[model samples]
Target: MRRLADASAPERRKWYARGAFFHAEDLHYLKFLIGEGARVLELGCGTGELLAALRPRYGVGVDFSAGMIGEAHKAHPHLTFLVGDIEDEAFIRQLPGPFDVILVVDTLGAVDDCQGMFENLHALCARETRLIVGYFSHLWYPALKAAETLGLKMPQPAQNILSPADVGSLVALADFEAVKSERRLLLPARVFGLGRLFNRFIAPLPLVSSLCLRHYTVCRSLRHRSADVRSASIVVPARNERGNIEPAVQRIPRFVEDLEIVFVEGHSQDGTWAEIERVRAVYPHYDIKAVKQPGKGKSDAVFAGFEVARGDVLIILDADLTVPPEQMPKFWEAIRSGKGEFVNGSRLVYPLEVQAMRFLNLIANKIFSILFTWLLSQRFTDTLCGSKALRRSDYARLKAARGYFGEFDPFGDFELIFGASKLGLKAVEIPIRYASRTYGQTQISRFRHGVMLLRMVVFAFLRIKAM
Candidate 1:
């Protein structure tokens, strides 16, 4: 650490410029992980370049090297910079915290005690705060060493060379849960047109992404402060599922203080709306409400129900009842216990019941799952699952960002998934047993819908990946 302080600004600038392409990739990825106007604190923020680019409402940068801090303060006057060691608990205790985002980019490998750093960061985080750690992949150590020896890269002291799993374990020991992890920057150096193609398309693929130059992990504190005790509102968007309405109302379990059921009936040819009213009448003890959707798609109905929902947690349950309402407790428990911020149902993990899903639809689901997992940089086994859960506040944030994807999603799944990813919410997939519907014909047109899904995939690429 003392050696870093001894280095001059010009020498550091030359060294950093040698890996300009790599730094650019890191900046782009970090911007995506953090939202606008967030209060951000960056550890080891050399020159404060990345912090300044984020345009944070409140930004504080800390580095042990006095030279680096001086350069950062000079370069980024808008942000606060101080020379302090993160490993020093006394110094960390003095810093104002509870930041929205805490960044430790490219500094974990240089730390003497990774767990101690995380523990100190824990004190600076709230329940909603996210800690993003970026480190070089140990697999690239030999190549990096060779580049340094040839003067193509900056020379550095011996690094700890920690793997993603090692960091994850350390995070857990420090009372933080790992939310998401990804590998990036497959083409570290610029190569004209080829670099964009490889990094944007080829490098994100499963087998190829493992060989990327850098790895990032996003984590959150394990303490359940805001969601310790909450109520729930289950929103069921029904099109032509009159037969299952009563059973859904009866089977939905209660795991919170109060549970309200909101059924948004789409324009169904059958008496689905009447059935919803009848169920409310039959179960007068249950807090149930029904509304007719003025629009066409399930997405419209979902938004309508959410508008009237009055609970701490909001949930989406399909009217077809393929995913049993009995599983609602698991979703509630997950968010309430702080296991995940966005809970998505995954039907692919378990064996499906007979005729649960048609062969063609199943195949399409599997294909889209893989494509979406790659696009979102998050593992999603069942992208079309209807049973999803999240906090009401989180849903409000997603609603505000809906214009990014526009009103294109008819199934209502991708909109939430994309929004959650954009907000950097921790998405957790809960495995559920899928069953065949007992009543009403299937509404999906396999061929037409499949084509629309393909178009959505392309849209995702343009919006999410191409950027």
Candidate 2:
């Protein structure tokens, strides 16, 4: 308690943000913390430098140091700055919250007890909130000790080093699951230009270079506290399948407490939107909406619908009815139970309905799934099933990771699948009954879609499997 109280005293934190390179790395870490427009509360924010760097929609920085709080306020007037102890629940609760991210940087070493500190921070966040924790790595102790002796590193003793395993175990006890971890550097200022180039191209590669100096972990709360959880938004893209919209909605057994059906009318020349709007009137009691496609294809329609979805969980439901809507619970339950971060409905495993898939399509699916699974070491039975569920938060993260893959996919499957792989998400497939589309026509030109799918498989193999 004394350590927590004194660690961030005004006098101690005044000198915290003097280094430019260190500040840049801290900003880089913040980019990983939250999506743009996310709410944030940074606990034990010394000089509130990190809070200032992140610039979230609602940024709040709390510190024990009155000096740090004052400095934080001056630098980021838009953010609410408070003087408080993170270890004190009453104090923590006083600060406004329900933040999307709870950030703690470099303060972990100062806390008297990591477990107690994490518990309090976890209580201040939303269920979908992510915890971004970063610390000086234990392996760097020798180098830091030497640097401190020569006045190169921060002047502090032994700095309460915790191993990666210890940190993981503590996070679990705090009821927050660790999703990812990695090392990054705060390059010295002497070679600023060269350092930028290294980080941009060279340093990110696994083979070349320095690690074990810094560690960052991305975490999610295991417990949820929302009083009234929002309904899952299910986005369905209908093309020529005008006949199937009614059954899809009718058979969509409401697994979630609240549900909204978003139908993206993919420029179907066969009056798919007309049928959708007709079905909409029938379900006026149910929350349903019809959105015209922003672009011509199913992928474009899905992306457009995802843009406006307002739900705790976002789901993609195929308009073809190939995967039954009743089985949606499987995907939802999988994510809720933490069985996997992504739950994809699989039709290849089951004896798909007679004439459901042409032999060529079946073979293509099997071949593509095998290549992707083998390449990523992530199992995938059916690649084209078109039913997947994840929270809106998860989807945002995937979109950010999409920078690694480029906008290479026209179908949007690779975008999600590859992001899940890169983020280290557990990708599991759920078998479902595949029913043939009862509609105007099949929009897929198998040869073209197959070629695209093959290209994606190869690309994923190089990016994820190689990594």
Candidate 3:
């Protein structure tokens, strides 16, 4: 412990001397996971620069080095700094707890017992608390060692050299589940014009991203207890889905608790609005509401229905009925089990019904899935699937942060998925068989929409991946 403290004593000044590109990049990614005004506690916090930058409502930083803690106090008096070993259970218990976000940046390697550090973190976290850990990638071991030898980086004590999988196992052992993980910072030092472009754009690409400098893991407490059955709202966005309205109303299964069906009719040449009214009257026993969409696009229509929905859980179901309404129970069950915070339906997992999707559309879906998996740092098999479910509270946060991507998404799928990723929410895909539509023609224009989707991908790269 004395040797560890001595090694990190000069780090605060050394970090500023050596261009802090990795530090800046790490803070950028962490800020996305932890929104503004969160209660944050950072372990092994050296100088507390990252904690100060996050602007948490309440911030506490702990370091094994008394010198580091003293420098942190002098640098950022607004936040509390303490000298304590994170692996010590008694020391961890003394710190203020129930933090919304707990950060461990690059210091896990220096810890004596990595698993003990994770176990101690549990005392500071709540059910909703998120634990974010960032560490140097073993792939960059030679480069980092060379930098340290050349005095370009601060010298450190011998590291535990844990991989992302190792850290994940330790977190699971400590009663937390891994939500998401990714590699970042391909260029740790500025290289003039190419630095921003390479690190932000090129580094996040599928095959290329694996060679980055650091790995970050986001984890949440494992909920062994089941969630209670809550009221639900299913929002159906109709734009030429007149023929499926009555069938949709009849097919939707009853929920254990309250269930309301909301129909948002967009501008359609067919009498979709009339069909919605007809279904509402026919299914008077069921809770149903109809409204004319004030704006264009499926995103606008979905938002309109969601605005009027009154349920604890909110869901989006395309009126085409390609994903059967019967699958709602499976989605509800996943959320009710506390297995996932965001439930996405995957059509690509199971074999699709004949003529359910065009060959070109199928290929496009597969391609986009690969792109999004890299972009969002989460496994996404089908990004265009029209069925998705989430808690109303989560939707509100997503809606508030929608401006980050702007109103570019017409499909409404990307907005939800992107927002969930930004919030570090656990997204689980529910596999469902895709069936051929029995009613109206497909509203999607294959070539035109495909081009738009490609543009959205680039937009996401700039907004999400590059960030």
Who wins the lDDT comparison? 1
Clashing pairs in 2: none
* Every candidate's lDDT: 0.86, 0.73, 0.85
TM-score of each: 0.91, 0.72, 0.92
- What residue pairs are clashing in model 1? none
CA lDDT, candidate 2, residue 425: 64
Q: Decide which is better by TM-score, 1 or 2.
A: 1
Quote model 3's TM-score. Answer: 0.92
Error of 2 at 357 (Å): 7.8
lDDT of 2 at 64: 76
Which candidate has the highest TM-score of all? 3
87: Cα error in model 1, Å: 0.5
- lDDT, residue 381, candidate 2: 84
RMSD (Å) per prediction = 2.5, 5.7, 2.3
Model 1 gets an lDDT of: 0.86
Q: Write the per-residue lDDT of candidate 1 for residues 1-467, one digit (tens) a residue.
A: 56755485547777777778878878887887787799999998877888898999999999888888888877889889989888999888888888999999889878999998898886788878889989988999999999989998877778889888888999999988887787778889888867767887777667888898888898888763347546899999999999989999888887766989999999888999888888888899999989998888888999899999998888999999999899999998888877788899999989999999988888989999999987887789999998999899889988988888877777888899999888778888999999999999877777987788788899888777665
